[model samples]
Target chain A: MTGSKTTEYVTLVSNDGYEFKLLRSAACLAGTIKKALDPTSGFIETTQNRVDLPTINGVVLEKVCEYLYYNQKHAESRDVSDMDIPPELCLELLIAADYLDV
Target chain B: MSGRRPRGAGIRGPHSALTDFLAANNISAQEIRDSYQQRVRQAEQEAAQTDDNGEGPSNGGAEVEEDLQAESSTMAAERTRKRKRDQDEAIAKIKKGKAAKKVQKKKQKKNSSDDDSDFEDVMDMYKKAKPLPGQLENCELCNKRFTVTPYSKAGPEGGLLCTPCGKEMVKDTKAEAKANKPVVRRGRRKMESNRLDGMTDCGPKTLQQLCIEKLAQHSEDIDELGEMPEGIMNRISEIFSKKRAMNSTTMKLFLQPDMDRVAIHEAAYLETEDYDQIFAICPNVKRLSLRNCCQFKDSNIDYMNEKARALEEIQLLGANLVSNDKWAELFIARGKDLKAFKVEWLDAAFDDEAVEALTTFCPNLERLKLERCKQIGPDSIDAIARLQHLKHLTLRFHDPITREKLTHLIRSIGTNLETLCLEHFLDNTSDPTDDVLATIHTTCTRLSKFRFTENNECTDAGYVNLFSHWSNPPLRYIDINSTRDLDNTNPDGPQESPIGLASAGFLALMTHSGPSLEFLDISSCRHISHETFTLVFDGVKQYPHLVEINLSFCPVVDTHVVAGIFRSCPLVKKVVTFGCFRVEDVRVPQGIVLIGAPRAQDLIEQFGEGSLDL
Candidate 1:
């Protein structure tokens, strides 16, 4: 829980066993992931420094990760450009966005 | 009957203000013109005599020309010096309005001696001594001799400049002007909304608001807002509709095949076919609410009648394009299923017959609202009276109806009503003993929100009777603005019993309903004296539920009354005191807002919620 143990990055594992090692700040952009990995809450994921999201598949999770990084990059800005989204995976990505609360 | 022009008849257009001022001082316009003409003729005669006696002395015309040339040469040198000094003064004047006033006074003194100088300047303007085309002329800026051309531009001081130098000067002036201009950036609408919310901060939006705005910015890029809670979906829909992103493509994502209700808050962008699409998608929907549906047509309703048979409630606003016959047909077809029906801003078609048809068909209807619909009149008053199940009734009409018909309408349906809002019965003959208010007091027992506004007809006694020992539970909202005597001659109305909601009635209203009242607007109830205001909001008696109160145009309300309101109404969030100029020096608490006081701007603490920095 102290500052000494805090890592620069955290791991996110998808339902299909794909792991993404993302910057801690970027990963915390998603509200659900932030709450899960919050140090004060003492969640299991907080100690482990990894979140396993079983409901979201790797394809959707990868898009969410890309969006999290994109959001962090343009957090304190105006007139931000939209991230590219594929037409076919829109519904699935929306489900992932809802789960992540982004 | 003297043959003179009538007063005010001659005023057809704007007359010269200077001419008026001269006429007021007894200096005639005719005399001024005649004297000017005589002076010109005398000067011409003297010049003619000089020409005739040319042999006696030197040539008069040549000598006069020589003297003028010598004066102009001296004037040119003086002008250059004056121009530099004037430019410096102009720059200083631009920085302060006070400096400009001093400069203008100095200019007036100079203008009196330069009367003929102005005339000479005008003459020189028409007869420029600049070199003609094909003649060699010195470039004013570079001091280089060049052939004069028609395309040459005049330099700032006077003489013509070479083409390149002129272009460079023009560019330099434009760039300088652009650089000196102050850039203004404003989020004016955001500021207005924040003011309405009693927020003084000019800071950035909250994180949630920002995220919603960003999501709504690119809503088209989103395919589905996929499976969030109902409240979140509606909130997203609200943001989307406000941003006007609820067109055909985005609308489809909002409606699911299984959802029972489809409420689109802003349907201004939807096409006529989209109305049919509501049924096409959500066929089993029970309640349908579409506002600003300007394109709603008869065929859409027909499609809905066939598809959406289980439709129990419908609210459509600004759907004026639908014919009267379509309204009758819809009521006939699905009237039995309807429990609540609200239609507003329908000026073109929906008439008294529509009400007749609704009452005849819809026996189960409980909530009815018809606001700002033009065509319905006294004819439908009795027809609406037939509905036994009406509870929440709001009728803000723009038409003619005698007190008799209105009294009948209220008496028949008032027993079951919960919220009654009646507006603009202004034309009704004054009732010193208001039969309508009497009926409301006796019959409507369940009312929580009551509004009777813009009436010069009801006497104060009527309101007094209604609230004094009334059977109805305490009302939560009361808005009775513009309910006073409107005689222009008497600023103070009849003093014996007072008129409209005066002291007795207002006190009675507070006594009965102050406990449960959450919102109150007694604006423009001018007859209620300052003593009554202070007595009612006396700081010791607490009205626990009151949140917002408007005392606008109530001129007698002072700082003491405002402070007492803060003490008495602990939950009060906003207190509007516009035109209550006497309300200064009150210290508002941290979360409370005190708005519209003329001199309360600087007095607001930094932590105070209502600080409006002027």
Candidate 2:
């Protein structure tokens, strides 16, 4: 928790005990994650490069992480296709998107 | 003859099947044709004797119609699985057997190419013919009885097909669709739409903005925006509001109940009962803002009065359902603690009595904005004079108030007011009287923003008097638009008084507030001459604080004046020149936007992509 060096990848722990290790650039696409990892604010997440999103479960968090990477990859591109999302998981993903402010 | 192979007498070779048949029956091609012609002639004579309107065409259309029926019924099915090649071949054969109705549809389409209703009707019937789940139906191609399911596919003909045949058809169509992916042409209209809601930077949007937009696109699937920050929630709600997707279901996402502020930017989709949920859930809410709340009735007001006791500020727009009495009651209940209240777009209620009640009860109220309240008249302005602690006052009534009452109101509440906005006074006469202007000048020394617009009454002398170093330091925002003389005959406006913000008044304004003015709108102040515009915005002088200036409808403004303005205001981001026709061309710098110009609209210089200089 007190580590000073910023890692290239961060671990996101979902509530159902699933941890996702992803690129820092992709993870920062989410406003919530970005603010948490903002070094100037000096939250524990900034030093450790890990955040426990307690409310979001494993399935939705996985999708959220996938979306973060997708958004980062297509940041400067045009004619990007829509991401394929399962209809059943749409509502939960939407809630997560709003919460993370993706 | 023997070389031509007509000599069966020369060689006892095997004869063709037709020759053998002809020899066996002793029938020639000529004899067969004569017999067919005789039969056709006999039949024609019989048809001529029995003429009727039943037969529209004698082109064997009835047989083709049956073949059509076979193809269409298959189109009407739910595609489930794919069948094999031989089954597809059999299904194709069945298509020809009962294709009766489809051919007739084709004939109708050919007859009247413009109208599609006839074809659509048959398609509609075919669509409805798909067998319901748990029903027994025979397959169109095989005529084999099978239990119908929701996934049952329509055969190639006209009825629901069994699983194998249906699946084959679905696969074929899927492949067909995959092969023929059409290119979508993205024209300028698409780019303009992207500029709306979405963005168009010098290049693509930033990563964060893209993610935010994607979230907004799939907002309906959102269950709740759980535990998000207030600013982000507000932003999400803003996007949702713009999309008009903020219905009862989506509205709950914005209610961070524990937080003091709850604002719904678009509440037009929310119903009467939806308003109740806010009170029930967000009991601790202090500042409640809802715009276009059309269904906000007396019941919701009562609910808020009872439950939202912590409420100090409430801004509601288009909540006309609350009667005038209810408004007074609300003020009576919550007015002591209320600091700011803005209620607008009232069609019938919130009259003079409501304003009187607000003044009488809400002593602690510091900000009050009432706009487009049709029932409120001059008496409401008179009532507002009684309030002592108001720091900001904005009023746009449906009826016009006299200049005398406005002056009295200003004199009474002007000292405490930091911002005073009065709109649509629209008086006809050119009284050259500066009563209200004089009152504002004398009393409102602390005012930073003064917006009094849509008037033809205040003359140039009044504006000059207001600004000529009498009292108030410098206004940061000033919008005195459409205050010119009304008479088209005397556009010069009485030579002595100079009605509206003419050359002298514009110069007076610049002399007073130019350094501190961040926003200034002297639009429709046509009396200001070309020389005055040039003098006011000369290239030498710099207006450091001017960020946006609207010179719309100022006829005297030309390219020279516009260029002068650009040179003068260094930090100006937007310059609106709507009706200034003489401004045909101007070089807009990067980051600065020139809107409604003849030659340069939204002209932002492309960076890192300009044509190479020779």
Candidate 3:
């Protein structure tokens, strides 16, 4: 956080108090985060530089964070057939995506 | 990079991120799995223990064990019988449920009929007590809560709706009502081929048909063909012509000796003698329009000239048998009294000499239209320009004339011209210049209608200049379709690159004279962009009088611009979009006629067969 060489990151806390530090660009992929962190909106999340998702648990939040990073990496690439999602977390991941409007 | 785990590693190894995350959070997946398995095994063991207790009594004492076993066996049999009775009762319950559903449906039907009668009674009450503003109600369509305002309108089914849903309901009901209208059949009469001789072999003839046949059979009893309405007379003549029943005797029904106006649309079967008989009967005919009069020969024309001397207007189409000299003689005989004369599709007759004779003899001619006349040249136009009383002139030339001759004609007939329509169908290289437009703008101050189609030489500068400061009264109709500027020098460029009227000229026309325009056709003027279209028709300046518009072949017009036109022009009743391929999803207002929009079939189909004239 001190030097320009270090990457800037934002902490997203889940309902069970699990914190996942993600890059700002990847976190902005979620529509909820984009609206909360909008500069003109003057939201508490924008001033505090942290967001708390009360509805999502730690396990589902972890999967959502990983998907956001994966989507950011393959945003423009057309060939993304190698990206795999576990069958067990499919239902939970869908619920989280709907909550975040991702 | 260090914080990021490799892809698919979270599902594989002991040190997977998911496992680490679960471990750090004090929640283990193995614990949950083992607990679930243990719960399932406990439930299974409890079920097995119950089965063993039911089957075995050896753990009790020997004497009591035998008696207990007997009692248990009898009790088990009784329980089995009870289970069978419960199964039967459940089946009866299901059948009863189905019958109850049928009874409920019958009751609902009765209630609906009662509601219909109640609704009629409520209509009188609703008329007395209309809903007031500021009342909260649930929208009938979406069930959303809304407060009724003064602007809220009632839905079609007597339900209340929010503002947005109310508008949609109105649109849907209008579309449904329009789609339900019975279509009127037109074109090419439907003749009954089987009942030609009024002898129906299978069924009895209709009362009307029987009456008509009896009247025709007893022709001697009918002494006079009594006075009938003109429309019915036309229908009777058309029926007679279609049935091949119009012989010399039936023709006498139409040819009354005292008739002043007569029009025969289908006279192809009328021979030369029949036409001579028409002239012999109707001597004082003032207005006569004959279509498909192929048997009208020189002798018939001579007879018409001698008998119908009071004729003021005559319209003849497909009268090609009358020779050019005979037409000239006819004009020379009665052209002075003729105020309006129209002839079309004369293949070999009515040439430049006849035009000279028309201009020379018909000094009081006010309306003259000669369409598809190939032999008329620049000299004929020069002769036509000399008529002082010519108010309406329409010339569709099959041969090209020089631009100088057109300019000379416009300049000569400047002040008195009210309606001028000039269409060129030849592949002529000569284009009308800006000077000709300027001459028209300055001279034709009284012009109310002007149509100049297929002149691919007029430029944007000329149109812009003509509309910039118009001194004439607002034109009621203006059609300049296909008047593009095709740059011959750079033919390989884009097709719409050099258009005659661009966005600037169109904007100028709208700002200056759009208020009074009732009919405007700018089809194939491809240089106007959607931005300019939206800007001009953005509900800022309303075109209250515009009724019909044709925007065909304009590539830039899309659905948004069409919606803007609907918003601005309140009186627009007819919109023709033939080749505007981008314009889809149009919302046609109620009572407005839309034509040739292929992609807007959802909206257009609401208007039944008679609504489209394509």
Best-fitting candidate, measured by lDDT? 1
Output the number of the TM-score-best candidate.
Answer: 2
* Superposed Cα deviation of residue A21, candidate 3 (Å): 86
Model 2 lDDT per residue over B1-614, tens place: 11123446586766699867864543445544544565566556646644654554565644554554544335322121123334454654455333545655666677675577676666755553444566566788778878778889877666898887788789999999978988567675655455332232343343334444566777787666666657666777888898888999888877766878889988999999999999888999999999999999999999999999999999999998899889999999997898999988888788888888998889888999999988888888888888889999998877767778888899889999999998887534335477888888889999889898887778888888889985787789999888887787876677777787888988999999988899999999988989999998887788899988899999988988987887888887677787888886566554455655655544422111222110
lDDT to native, each model? 0.79, 0.78, 0.71
Query: Candidate 3: which pairs clash?
Result: none
The true-versus-predicted C-alpha distance at residue B83 of model 1, in Å, is 87
Evaluating just chain A, the predictions reach TM-scores of: 0.93, 0.95, 0.87
Q: List, residue by residue over B1-614, the lDDT tens digit for candidate 1.
A: 01122357865555599867854554545544544565456546757777687744347655665565566556544654675567555654454344344444465567758767566545644654566555556799998877678988889988898878878888899999979988544464543455566753233333334445566778888766667556657767788898899887888877888888888888999998888888998999998889999999989988988999889998999999899999999999887778889999999999999989998999888988888999999888788888899888888888867888888999999989998988886455444458889999988999999999988778888999999999999999999988998889997899987778999999999999999999999999999998888899988888999999999999999988988888888888888888988988776664666777876666633224443221
| Candidate 3: stretches off by over 4 Å | A1-102, B1-256, B425-432, B486-497, B602-604, B608-614
For candidate 1, the docking band is: incorrect
TM-score of chain A of 1: 0.93
Which of the two candidates, 1 or 3, achieves a greater DockQ against the reference?
A: 1
Q: Sort candidate 3 into its docking category.
A: incorrect
Q: How does chain B score by TM in each prediction?
A: 0.66, 0.67, 0.59
